[model samples]
Target: MRLRLVALAALLSPLAACSTVSEAVKGPELAPVGYPAALVPRDQSVLPLASAREPLPQAASANSLWRTGARAFFNDQRASRIGDILTVQIDIDDSAKTTNATTATRTSGMTAGVPHLLGLESSLGKILPGGFDPANAIETNSSTNNAGSGQVNRSEKISLTIAAVVTSILPNGNMVIQGTQEVRTNAELRQLTVAGIVRPEDISSANTIRHTQIAEARINYGGRGDISRVQKTPAGQSLIERFSPF
Candidate 1:
């Protein structure tokens, strides 16, 4: 019984050592769950467009038609102030088609012979096999043909309306805008983000502007859900594949 107990202990010792070694190789463990909300920090408040060089006038002159450099009437609803919200119309319809074809052919032939050098034809015939003409001693022929064709056809269209906030006013009076919209259904979340600079004069009378008018624009639309997880590889396996040389 004592010998049997000793044998069992010896068998378990290697497993314990292996577990320790595996833990060391793995280094640190990650959290089992992820917090999607913590991906980006939330802004508590909007920042000013620029620093005020001088205090605003306490009161406007009575006879002055313009009040404190106002560009339009007070009733105009155009977006001119920081933190103001405006509607942005996103309409994108794009299509492209391209085709290319290439063909190449190459052929080469080589022949080497010695007719009669130093009158050694008889000697060469004796050394060479019968009907083996020295003129055709070394003849080679090669042909190569290559053909390639490629085509691309793509079309995309997205139409949506999103409300954007005036994040900042540029020195040239352009407005920097940013907008985000998120929709949640069941366990899925779809997010859309847009940011860009727009000229104030380009805004329509209806207080809206098309996405095409935006400069340096960035748009993103995607979703995260069960379907997304199904399309993605496991995190551990993805890491291994990325680091693998073969």
Candidate 2:
């Protein structure tokens, strides 16, 4: 019986040796799910890129426009330095327009190759106010264009404020920022100054132009809004109401 068992074991060993081993190695691998890559985080407190904020359309606001703030804003005497107390005010009003009758286009917003700094100077001193100076001006000439569910509200003037400490000035006249801040002008102050500047391209609707002004103010933020009086949420509205978009 022992001899017979040994013979059977030898036969099984030879049969096992006759079988071939696979050259390809097999291992566990992962399958990719069809999920998209993560998106970047955003802070909605500020304006979003490519969002609808354009200068006022068709309806003209003012006539006198100048790119420089009193021409003094860019003067050598006006160049500020660190520790200088710079009082900055942003404004929109009819007085800020500049226009030439030679380049005037009808109110259709399709310009006949014209230029304006948020306004047409032709209207300045000629028919509209003389100059749109911010420090001593009021913005009270906004007109509303409402169509169906989309209603656009324009303040005749909307002014936003920003400030910088002037850490350093580049040799070629670019001012560096030590620290800068933005301020929300009083609602009373912005009520009438809705003059939006028409830059190289017409990217401003009266409202968007206003919004761009606010973004510029952020270059060097000034300070926080004095919104302590404002309730975190409207009275009688639930906490959910503050965040319920759906």
Candidate 3:
């Protein structure tokens, strides 16, 4: 009995370890807050190594009040070069409703008869069931009906604001920006990420741009930790649901 118990324990140890490993693999671990390195391009440099052109010394005009390239008290703060920071406004409000109905019906009938066949009709009447008519030798009728109805209603809305850093600049003067924000409440950690391309002209004077202005935009908002894990279905259950034919 002692040997049997020891062997059973040994066999179950691997199964317990496998279950622990599967749980760890199913959920994403909370990431520490830091720069989103994945959004940066490998070939491009985040900061300019040197100025495109050396700035020429502006000769002081003794009589003029304004100098060359000097703006009136205020300056443009829009993001135009790599390494610049700008705010992105995301406001998504969408709703959809669809209904479909299909109905089909068909009916058909066919009749064949042999009233006379070389004087054999009388002989067939005696062999066939009583009250059988020669005029109606074969008759068939069929009907089919099909009806289907479907309805769908969905709605989604999300509003947020995040600051993003310019990662790269295109030849067309567009800038690619990416940002990640993380917040931890107790054990749960919420993460938000945004990345996209935007034109310099679309940026407002306040250095903010709407989400719609960003082309090829990608936004994700989710959480990791105890709460999220509880909300998600177990890995084993999810696998069975996905592979089950019924």
Candidate 4:
């Protein structure tokens, strides 16, 4: 079953916000708007895959389950497949900042590493043919992603993007898509984990930001695992540059 995060995240899709008054004073230049080389705005989002991964023999027969809500704010959804070439773009506004989990201990930058991701993850589930049972077909349990960078400390807002394609599907119904991803990290060590720069061992490294073994504790790190490589955003720009549900 899907590990429901908050009580809302897993259920709701992204909302398109529009019409906001200019908070800053006069603007100098207008930012670029249109299809960039980073993305292929074509007739349709192509996602051609070969096969699925082998089913989880370790998986229990079946079980009943339910979903809960989540507290995710910045996120994206894209149509994906087994194989498709992709490009990515990143943007950041170096002026966004916010309080940490506690004012006594400000977390990373409030707006740094905002994401504009374009990727395809496996839909790990049983193939019932008549669509699928989201409730029964749960993604395999994902371990804590130790993940991240000192960039979380910067007083800024940013967004990054990645492009990928599907490689093959596994028996367990996990779609093996191929695309450049931000990365997943270990929660305990706050080291880079997923696709980006920081290697899993980096976070699994002894000199982690939180300084702990990946097997022992947990770290609530962010930003493509822990690589603090968010790009600078243009002045007077929104936190999220742009995205698609492809």
Better of 1 and 4 by TM-score: 1
Where does candidate 1 stray beyond 4 Å? 1-48, 51-72, 114-138, 232-246
Candidate 4: tens digits of C-alpha lDDT, residues 1-246: 245654345333343342223422222223322222355433222233322222222222245222111112221122122343323233445655444342232234222221222421124223335544443433343334343333334554435444434344333233332233334455322222111111122221121211221111111224421234333244345423322222
- Model 3 residue 167 distance off true place after TM-score fit, in angstroms: 1.9
What are the RMSD figures for all models against the true structure?
14.5, 37.4, 11.7, 34.7
Task: Enumerate clash totals for all models, in the order shown.
Answer: 0, 50, 0, 56
Tens-digit per-residue lDDT, 134-222, candidate 2: 33333333344433333344435545543334333323222333233433577311111111112212122121222342221232212
For model 3, give the 10-residue run with minimal summed lDDT. 47-56
lDDT (10s digit) by residue, model 1, range 49-100: 4542222233455986554433465544667678778899999999999999
Query: What overall lDDT, based on C-alpha atoms, would model 4 receive against the true structure?
Result: 0.30
Candidate 4 — which residues are off by over 4 angstroms? 1-80, 92-153, 157-162, 168-246
lDDT winner, 2 or 3: 3
Candidates' TM-scores?
0.58, 0.24, 0.62, 0.17
The per-residue C-alpha lDDT of model 3 at residue 93 equals 95
Model 3 over residues 1-246: C-alpha lDDT tens digits?
999999877756555434344444474443333333477433433334243122323456688755433444333455666678999998989899999999999999999988998989889979999987889999999999999999999998989999999877654456789998999999999988988878876888678999999877888888889999999888777655444434
Candidate 1 lDDT score relative to the true structure = 0.71
Q: Candidate 1 — worst ten consecutive residues by lDDT sum? A: 28-37
Ranking by TM-score: 3, 1, 2, 4
